[model samples]
Target: MQTTKKSSGWHLRDVIMLTLIAIFFGFIFWIWAFAYDAVAATPLKPFANDITLGAWIMAGPLAGYLLRKAGASFLGEFLAAFAEMIIGSQWGVSTLLSGLIQGIGGELGFALTGYKKWNSFSLVLSTLTSTIVTFGYDLYASGYTSYSLGMLITLFIIRFLSIGFFGGVLVAAITKLIDKSGILNR
Candidate 1:
């Protein structure tokens, strides 16, 4: 049988697990930041670079699914971004704001479901929303606004697909594996 928490507050285990998720994904984001930079240096940056944005949003759904609580997505993603900051993101302090916005966007999906939908569809919706949110932020922050309209639309599509795959599908898969481990009972 599957387990789910219907509690109202955070517990010690939730903190520890959430922190672990944050730390793990934070490191992932840090590494991805470098990877994105390297990619940005190439000709591919004009069209395909936005795909990498997907990896940055994983912690939100991962934590939300595991913790099954309000704010899990936001807290998890925010801390992960904070971790990326400590590790020295190329975007500097702006990574924190990006994390905050992306996380809140992720939280919006679960919140709309009343915190009860922990399935693939919900995760997909969650990631899609985060993509839009972050992509919108990047339009101004990353100077994507200066690109042609065609490139902007292409970037949006790439980013949406990337986040949907990584943040939604990939994270859900990992969480299922963790559930099968019989570790968190979540």
Candidate 2:
């Protein structure tokens, strides 16, 4: 008799869970827009977006950590962007492109782990990749290329810190809470 390993494909439950995550984060992203605008109006306008970017991309890493599956991060981030768009985000359709880029960045961390480790290291890596990927995107898309090298460095540092805090620290906390609540076992 031949023995075969069980496939780890996504089920309906996973879909529902991912959807809920996307919706929740989508709403959060929508509200975050106002906060972004407020920050932009300050003297720190140039770095405001970088400082607040981590919160915007949290859904991807959060979903990847929770789901522990390939493509979860991408789907989570993309769907959240979709939901944010549906909620009438100020960025309009451009949000979708951001989501796609962010999702790929978020997914790269787990991909580096071969979809095996979903711990602090992976989360940190996610933050790093997200910062790099998003910053790269902004170089042309958001006109970061026009900035001085010093300003670029400053933006990168701020972006990494922001992503590290929200996508790494906060995500670990949320996952820990979920684990403690025994929700996944149900």
Candidate 3:
């Protein structure tokens, strides 16, 4: 009988898989951020920062599902941010800070479950956590708090869509895909 190690909660293969996922997120964020800046003044303005929240919804819960661990989401997000910084993100040093906070927000969902289990429901919860945290980040970092009530409402709606669509649906789909691969089988 092969026994899992106690000290190392992960294997080399697990690290490799999570690292690739993290890198994928870094690319996704970079492209999405640039697209936001380009089209913010246009008719697609609502789609601007909204995608930022969506990205977390997709990446965070998916990481948790893939690794089935407590810290995997956070580790993946942090790796993604590190990759972004190394790859020359336009957000500069602040990207690292945002990644840290955002990762923690996403990780909260998995943490709430005590890292014992995850499902589509848990993915939704994780996405919601990411949305709330990122929204707060926007209020302070992006100065959204200075905006009017209507704008705030609009922001909230966008965040809801981001989390619901990306975290709930997208992550669920991806998790199913990974599970079907049997790569995570213990």
lDDT string for model 2 (1-186, tens) is 011122357788888989898999999999999999999999989988899999988999999988888888988999999999999999999999999999999989889889889889999888899998999999999999999999999999999999999998999999999889998786
| lDDT tens digits by residue: candidate 1, 1-186 | 011254447678778878887988888888787788788788887654576888988898888888778889888998899888888887789889988988888998888889888888779779877987888888888788899888788788888888888987788779889878998763
Per-residue error (Å), model 2, residue 102: 0.4
- lDDT values for all models: 0.82, 0.90, 0.76
Each model's total of backbone clashes: 0, 0, 0
For candidate 2, give the lDDT: 0.90
* lDDT score of residue 64 within candidate 2: 91
Q: Candidate 2 vs candidate 3: which has greater TM-score? A: 2
List model 3 lDDT by residue over 8-45, tens digit each: 88888888998898888888878877766776778777
Which candidate comes out best when scored by lDDT?
2
Q: What's the TM-score of each model vs. the native?
A: 0.89, 0.94, 0.86
Scanning candidate 3 in windows of ten residues, the lowest lDDT window is 1-10
Q: How close is candidate 3 to the true structure, as a TM-score?
A: 0.86
